[model samples]
Target: MRLRLVALAALLSPLAACSTVSEAVKGPELAPVGYPAALVPRDQSVLPLASAREPLPQAASANSLWRTGARAFFNDQRASRIGDILTVQIDIDDSAKTTNATTATRTSGMTAGVPHLLGLESSLGKILPGGFDPANAIETNSSTNNAGSGQVNRSEKISLTIAAVVTSILPNGNMVIQGTQEVRTNAELRQLTVAGIVRPEDISSANTIRHTQIAEARINYGGRGDISRVQKTPAGQSLIERFSPF
Candidate 1:
């Protein structure tokens, strides 16, 4: 097994080097846009489909200007079904601060003696060291002191908006949503993804919802390009740092 692993590593070394070289030369490329299902799988805490559904509408009148099934005018445009689109507004401004301190001290001492063990104290001078004292046969002392302090401060702010699709409807009327947006400027590619569950009642009449209203939300914002590559540590250095003891 060791020999096989060594051979496999040897074979993959060139490929790894080629990948690193290519990335350094060309920077990082953007990922292609795809279906939200690829990002939010069904098993990712998403609820199952509801067994009951609203009945389909009956056919419209033949001689009427306002068709029963038509969305001509004055119809509610809010997203209420699977595949319908809705806007998601995200505005975050969070901060945190923490401080802690600890101190501990301990001291102990012990002594034991056989001062009158069958009158053997007199013979102890001959059997042991000349200054040996039978009254104090064993003595020990110990002391420990510890002190620690820690502090942390952090802040975050983000503001943006994106459209999301209703992927599923739960039995209790909650909808699971997922969306991804990407933009490329020169050699840089920015990506933003959002997925979560929302209640229809929380949605505004304008078909928009706030990030705070989402449950089990997962939001990601990042980019790839020459700037990111320059800021990132090399894979070899990262591996070494991870395995190093100091």
Candidate 2:
């Protein structure tokens, strides 16, 4: 009976070891099981707010076609107020090329001699071996040459349009903008984000502005899903590579 009990314990030990190994190798949990957290409203504290300023007075004539300090057109579509939305046209084309070269060369020679020092030349033959030239003593010659070259070439282009909202108005009337868009297709989520500051005058009549018109602009485009994972190295392998000497 004791032998049977020992055999049962040995069998269960390997099962427990397998479970532990499985847990360690498991991939991180997929994003939460429901709607993405991005859908929820962002914390108000993170968004920029307009500074307190005295409101501008309205036109003196209520029936006037033009109001003081207002755009001449009544249907102006430019984005100027907080919460107003506008489109941003992104057009990026960049190319760069660089080449570097370095060259170096050096040559040196050294020699030492003792001729007729204290009349030692006459006795040198007796102390030194025959055919040994004192003038050639300690003679040396060296030369070195080095050359290096490097070249780099790169090009990138992106063209798209995304909607942005005015988040704040500066004291000078400039607008701060932030925008985020996500598209999910076949379990993959592609996201694009844009944030910047823009002058109200930069907005075109169609309520659109080019990316270059923005100041302090930041743009990001990427995606995550099974395809993204397949393109990435395994976490365990990556960790090992990070600590490896080679």
Report the C-alpha lDDT of model 1 over 1-246, residue by residue, as the tens digit: 999999877766655434344454544544432324565554433344453234223346688656343344545466667778999999999999999999999999999988897877889889997788888899999999999999999999999999999887765567888999999999998989888888876878778999999877888888889888888788666554444434
Mark the regions of model 2 whose C-alpha exceeds 4 Å error after superposition.
1-72, 112-134, 234-246
| C-alpha TM-score for every candidate | 0.70, 0.59
Identify the leading candidate in terms of lDDT. Answer: 1
Candidate 2, residue 36: Cα displacement in angstroms equals: 34
| Candidate 2 per-residue lDDT over residues 112-227, each given as its tens digit | 87665787776777888887666665688999999999999999898989999977776556677889899999989988888887877678767888999887688877788999
Global lDDT of each candidate: 0.75, 0.70
By TM-score, who's the top model here? 1
**Given candidate 2, what's the lDDT at residue 240?**
47
The TM-score, computed over Cα atoms with residue i paired to residue i, of candidate 2 is 0.59
